[model samples]
Target chain A: MSAGALPPRVRIVEVGPRDGLQNECVALGIDDRLTLIDRLADAGLRDIEAGAFVSPKRVPNMAGSGELMQRLPRRAGVSYPCLVPNDTGLDAALAAGCTDIALFAAVSETFSQRNTACSIAESMDRLSAVARRALDAGVRVRGYLSCVIGCPYEGAVESRKVADMAARLIDMGCYEVSLGDTTGIGTPAQIAALIDTVAAQVAVTRLAGHFHDTWGMGAANVWAALQRGVTVFDASVGGLGGCPFAPGASGNVATEDLVYMLDGAGIETGIDLRALVDTARWISARLDRAPASRVARAFPPTPER
Target chain B: MSAGALPPRVRIVEVGPRDGLQNECVALGIDDRLTLIDRLADAGLRDIEAGAFVSPKRVPNMAGSGELMQRLPRRAGVSYPCLVPNDTGLDAALAAGCTDIALFAAVSETFSQRNTACSIAESMDRLSAVARRALDAGVRVRGYLSCVIGCPYEGAVESRKVADMAARLIDMGCYEVSLGDTTGIGTPAQIAALIDTVAAQVAVTRLAGHFHDTWGMGAANVWAALQRGVTVFDASVGGLGGCPFAPGASGNVATEDLVYMLDGAGIETGIDLRALVDTARWISARLDRAPASRVARAFPPTPER
Candidate 1:
């Protein structure tokens, strides 16, 4: 990042409220969920992942995403996107008035089989169907490609494979595609190479970077992608949401850490970092675990405090 | 990182006992300190920083480093390094039977002024004096070069300047010179380039990698250094310790996370991940903050989970 270069004007998608909280076994009440989202909105996050609409039986923690969405503060201009894994999930999100929806795919065929109980082609077809339906219904679609660099089951995903997958999603009507190093096994050089290859097919403007901190290279991978002209990022609040598929995979790049990096680099992320800290604290307590965010832990020591 | 090939072994200097916890306002009991070090040792860590010997009035958290060192567990093949900023710290650590001592310097002159309350040359002189005394005492001296990539007072650090400071430290009889990206502004390309430049003047084996996660690139930076055949790394348990000169900087790369990366890549770190997590949890509780480790959270959901 150049010292006097104009800071990037970027849209930060806060995944804490949805992806951050959904995977936990902790059963936070709907009130707490609403408070979490409202607090995040107040913190200046223009795009917050309100919740996932997966089956409550499978994801009890996200049972009331619909109810929580209904009670959200009526704030114009702040887009709330939700996850849609299947038609049922799409219906759930649509009923909740989600104008933007995301569909996820795994780079490794083996991972897709285990994660979504479908083959790569089958999963893409499902997402394509969802994309077409959502687009016809006047909603924007975002595609997520997981394990773009490596996978626990299949290991080292080729860059060309990732780019092909991304291009397929773009052709399926996804306005943007997020390439995720779900296992956090990316080296900067490898990651840069991956982005370069992906950019050959997709415009950099239509790309977002998502990384897990499994091997502790999430932010570095993000930086590598950003240097390749990726402007959007997907972060979880308190850095929550470890991959259930990748047993040792940790949380995604932390929202607080992301905001700090952007702010330091003179990029405008429109997030109140202190407020994110408060949200991280609240959610972590609900889950009874330490927050995954470095910025949350690195907050200024209390004076007399 | 090849499976069949000999895995690269990175020597991680556990700095939590000294550098990590020294700046904390929290007062940990001697029993807690010993327990923490014991856990780390059991976790396969051969080098565990027991504590620092700074004055109680100046740095209250490290006042008991001298006492803690005296009561450390009698483990064979372990090196208990302590921070000896000057003659006083050196005397305290040596009396406590610490064979290894560390001295600090900064690549940025401005940071050296604020952090040490002295010029860079003055800090090096102090370090040289300590190194001479320790060498005469049959103790190994470890030199630290802080703000190697960027500084709080000085926004960007030149690689050549870092090499110069590191070279001086090695010449002063320090056994190994650990490079600190104090402001966490280093990217992989920058790191690789710096290592290449530094390797021209110094034996690569004598240099260690020390990075802060403030920008979320610490582990990536470590990997970059590793690719260039530099094997030593300095990490803190729970990713503790930040550059006091750089306000809001994240702590050093979490020890557990570093061990995970090395282990995952088929490299030998000789550190047990589970034991490291336990130690991190204990210390994080003491400080009333979350562990800065990604792998700790990335652990498989326990039955107690």
Candidate 2:
């Protein structure tokens, strides 16, 4: 349980612009979203989820994703990946000149159907087509397997089912798969078990942890996954996103909080903690809500205060 | 690590009444304080820090602690321990017919002097006298060592210093020693190293973790300690305490959040999570603040909402 047991360097997948804002009630314009993304890059985040190429009608908050993706500043060593649900979304991403795209699936049947309007098997079949087309277009594809631990619709998801879906995504040309506790109900023990079962099917190095802070177990879950050799993590600046099912609950773990923990552990993340906190504060102001990160709250009080 | 690696059951020492509320701006009457303690016991908390026997001028929130202790319902298994800083406080506790009392010291020299108006050596000398007298009175004495990880005034504190102080407290007749992260600045790696060094001097079973959630590392720190075989933890019901220096930062990790994680991990805490969350909400309402717990926030929205 020493620092040696954890990875020397951790790659954080900043999901604020996409997953974080997508679930927010307030809709930011493409310009505001671009500002958030720029701030994140300036804070030293290399992997940023810029936007999702889904329909604007269903998700008004993601209305200008295609435009946002096109206007994103392509900084050196920084990659902005967009989420593409089906072939149409893949087409939109391609039209917008997206070089990296993320494909998502759910391990739970009810969640898959509710989230994507298709069964788990059908969603995979659709994602397989999108992945094949995106790869053929020379785009690097990453996979997100949601509800790997628990589902709001279905209480507990079987680890075997998650592993099977992750293996399928890997087979479909995904370089890495991120296991997500969508409900944020997972404990460290459950996270450990899920990672242990899934790592057997997918390489441990190819696994990332995407945890929410709904139940305040996000940091502990990340620690568990880190101990099991998962280096990459998905976090949102300002701890954006509220659970639609569980109102007032947090969504993605805050990037500032994650960086604070990693920095304190002597784990190199290449991210500046002060700049990250500043960015969290900036974006939270734009969103008109207090940053949901404890680290951000713990920062020196603003001069206005 | 799996669930089997963790201890089967954990002893939670509820510090909300003393450590939590002592820092709050709003002061509750003794009746409200008694109600909080009663609700905590109803939620299955056995060890509660009822109040501090310090001066009312310094900490007006605990003015009627002696009277509060006299009015406490003598439950079958519940034990309410009050914080007694010096011989005068110990005498006050004894006069109140208290059977259990706690003594606190700081690991950092500056924090010891700043917090207790005495150096580390002097504070220990004072506490040793208090511990001796309390033990001779057929009372149980617990020890709290603050700034074990980091100090607001002294930056980083050495683990060796913390271990030495802990050993001294143990030798002076404390049944258990609670290591506190007063600044909430310790990470899992540091926590692991601290526990590893301290456990060599004192039995892990007699050590407790009292973490602050200022930087969102509380649960992770608790997990690290749990992995090192430390089973007891000190927590506040609503994450009640706030770091006086770090404006807007959290103080103690919420008891409800801890119970949620432990319950999800199949670890027996003997505490009902729903009941705990209710208590958190109730106390937070009385304090006119939102519960600083993700689990409490994520609970099914109140009827008023």
Candidate 3:
């Protein structure tokens, strides 16, 4: 790759409010959730996954996402997308006035079975109805393909299978397909091959990378995606949220850390790194844990010296 | 760059024993140092920085490095190198029957003053004498240039100055020059520029990447170096050794994590990752802290189900 082939700018889809907090041990109050979304918006993130519309019985941490969406202040250029797993979830999101929605399916049969309690095909069939309804309602739809790199139960996954699944999602009216390394087990070489395979079917511009930091390969995997011309990325504030299915796995790639690297690379992300760090610290303290973002710890905001 | 441009194999200089323990909160006993070295050798790391020969008053953790080196069981193909800061350190190493030695300097004047208590020119002059004496004694000398990307005190460092320092080290009979991100403040773009600038004066093969994970950019920076044809790297076991100068910074990139990424990228490192992870867990437990290597935590060895 030419050194100059890197994108001049990249879009960051903040997923902490949904993906990050979903697995948190302590449930953040609705006001705390609103603060997170508002802080992320204030930090200049244009796209934020506010929350999901799944049953509170399954994911209690995201119980009042609809209320959060209702109370969330509308920013001029910001888009807050809510994840909708089925028709009921989508209906709730619509009732809450969500203009953007995300539907997720796993590329591997084992992950689809264990995570969604359905086969890959069955899950896709379910999501298709949700996607159709969202599109009909004029809501922007984003597809999430879990286990795009590897599955905890199934080990390695074929890149072609991931690419085919991504293509199907795009055909099902997803404006963009986010390939999620749900188990956080991807490497740069695997990422390159996966992106190349998926880009062959779906346009690279329509793909976003959502890597977890379980193995500390998140930023490196993002670099691999950037090299392959995938511009949009999904990261979480404070690196919150581990995969409940993948025990011992860490959280999603921290948005603050990603922004630090991107800013240092001279790429335009339009994110205030300091503000993101503050939000990360704020949420992490409320959760009674250290912020998982290394940059936030390493370069903590210094008082005016 | 062609996908095949990546090197088929890479050499890792495991520096956990020397660079790692030097800055630790607890001073591991001599037996612990030997066990760490022996375990690293068992894990198929041919090149390991076994210890250092600095003043014990300054670095108490490395006080028994000479004795540890003397008693270390000589392996058939393994090479243990000790960090030698000056002629006295080199003399101590020689008295202890060590053959491989590393001399370190910083590209920035402020780091030289703070870390070595000497100016850049003065430190280089002292190291020049040590290098000559060591080469006369048939010892292999390796040069370490700290703060190649950024300095804790001086902030951003010029790539040209770093290259000049590396070229000088090579000219002084160092077999290889390792560029160190002592503060771990480097980005992939900066790594690329640093490698590109240094390769202009020295062959890329004679250069090694020694990055810290303080900002979680170590692996990404390593990826950039690999793309620029750098095939040698330095990492610590369990991601040990926080920087004394840079508060709240993480340690060197964990050797297990680096090996995991390299192995997944299909690069031959000749390392047994399971053994490395076991060693990391063992030492981390002894230190009363969790292993910083995320892979070790995520994929802990499980008994056959």
Candidate 4:
């Protein structure tokens, strides 16, 4: 938070099960999704995005999210969050006994229309209704602001628009807002400007960075965000998820790689790096792909030497 | 150079022809090496590590450094620097008409012994001789300090030792020193500490960051160094080179990716990104492997869209 000082510890929101698997070509079974959440908890992640309440026809891989929430092993400190787009999704999440839900919105008008089939204001209205209903049921709600940095349809996003959207989400009773670089086209300068603009209106503690590694700038952007006093991040295990807009681009920043850098920087993440590495390896094996995590690929567990 | 400001213009030392191709499983011919150098020059990279004068048996891929140098088209503004380990290598490099040479040493004692077949002190002595002779012969000598952050054999490296080695290299009449994370195991904190310590002993203007992307922290580390006044970076085209000590790891930061970040950040690199992207695609196709560069993979040149 101070000049050249990092937070003592940061919270990692594991989105491998929801944000990650939702984009994968392989349709993982409900059991696999449950196991992934369980492994993330065992690896000391307290915030895990378990699944999303979306149309099965649209996202077949996340079809059994409700089922996953029902059978997921409950941990003491871990909270499983599910994405709920509207009142219908919220009702399904509540029926499945979900305790935490996330509302997704886009700051760019074009992206808002393209992604959610509505303008930014209309999407916000829907999200506000879902947030209000979820809060009435004593369910904690988080918000995801996509295209906060760049949009595929639109070139660059305004920082003022991002700040206003985040403030609106917080006013709607969302606990935290995760800024998503959906196109992964952000550089450090843009990240600094965005964080600075948003921090002026909202506390840095309430902001989260969800960067993709499409151009290998994820860690750099994360560093920029940290310098601006943001302490929460969204990462996917084995770096699952690809940018549908930008072909051949990578997905979210790998949790293992993020944890490795955080730990090496002497920042406490309350994460078991080895255990997280194991989880990454496990899921990557199940996906029949080499672990997309650079740390997992470079530093596999070695016997005493 | 300042606390949070990046340099307006940075120098990119392209090492793809030598550092990159040398580690490739495919052995490119002398003509191909010349073509790679010319292509890099055409892409607006003035500084290029053209070849290294090493043992033919040890690195057959770079065995024809002399012939490649002889046939390389002489560009007025572009300089091809060769890696010269000792007096013998210096002699070969001089015979090849190299005007610029680089001498490498390791700060970690174990890495020095393993990589150069000598102790740290002995390796420095050899490098000192090469630097002195090259300087007297009107050749610009650059120093490379490897294992400045982490060593595969020795584990964590101390910043003080790295600073001392860099000071010794500068004292030996080397024009500049490129601090290298040979194992690619450095984090931002370590990068800041190393650069700060080294800056105390040597002018920050004379320091360069040569980070590998083995663990995907290359861009972040580079950003840290940039914050601390590093103005030059060593990157491989198509992300070539591999650490023999660290298996299954990536090579130097990809030149295209680095340039893309710099350009996006409003920094001047004097490179035509589209031309560089074409070079990466051209070379990658020759190797029959996808370009390891994230930017090249994501944003290929497209006709008016």
User: Which candidate tops DockQ?
Assistant: 2
Worst 10 residues of 1 chain A by lDDT: A1-10
User: Clashes per prediction?
Assistant: 1, 0, 1, 0
**Model 2 C-alpha lDDT per residue in residues A1-305, reported as the tens digit of each score:** 55677789999999999999998878899999999999999999999999998889998899988888888879989999999999889889999989999999988888888889999889988889989999999999999999898888878889998898899999999999999998898999889989999999999999999999888998999988999999999999989896344455677999988998888788999999888999899988887887888899887754652
- Please state the i-RMS of candidate 2: 1.5
Interface RMSD of each: 6.0, 1.5, 1.6, 2.6
Candidate 2 regions exceeding 4 Å error are A243-246, A301-305, B243-246, B301-305
- Tens-digit per-residue lDDT, A164-265, candidate 1: 999999999999998888777775556767888999999988999887766676766666566667789888888887533445546777887777766655
- Residue B199, model 4: Cα distance from true site in angstroms: 0.8
Greater DockQ among 1 and 4 belongs to 4
Report residue A39 deviation for candidate 2 (angstroms).
1.3
lDDT of 1 by residue, B55-148 (tens): 7887777778777888886789999888888997888888899898888888888887887789988888888888999999999888888887
TM for every model, in the order presented, reads: 0.71, 0.97, 0.97, 0.97
- Please give the ranking of all candidate structures by TM-score, highest first, separated by commas: 3, 2, 4, 1
Report the candidate with higher TM-score, 1 versus 4.
4
Model 3: pairs clashing at backbone N, Cα or C within 3 Å: A1-B1
The 10-residue segment of model 4 chain A with minimum total lDDT is A242-251
After superposing candidate 3 on the true structure, give the runs of residues whose Cα lies further than 4 Å from its correct spot: A243-247, A302-305, B243-247, B302-305
For model 3, how does the per-residue alpha-carbon lDDT over A78-139 read when each residue is reduced to its tens digit? 99999998999999999999999999999889788887899988999998988898999999
Q: What's the residue-level lDDT of A234 in candidate 1?
A: 89
lDDT of 4 by residue, A1-305 (tens): 22248888889999999888888777899888888888889899999999999999888989988888888878888899999988889999999999999999998888888778999999999999889889999999999999998889888889999999999999999999999998788987788889999999999899999998888888888988888889999999888886334466588999989999998888888989888988888898888777777888887675545
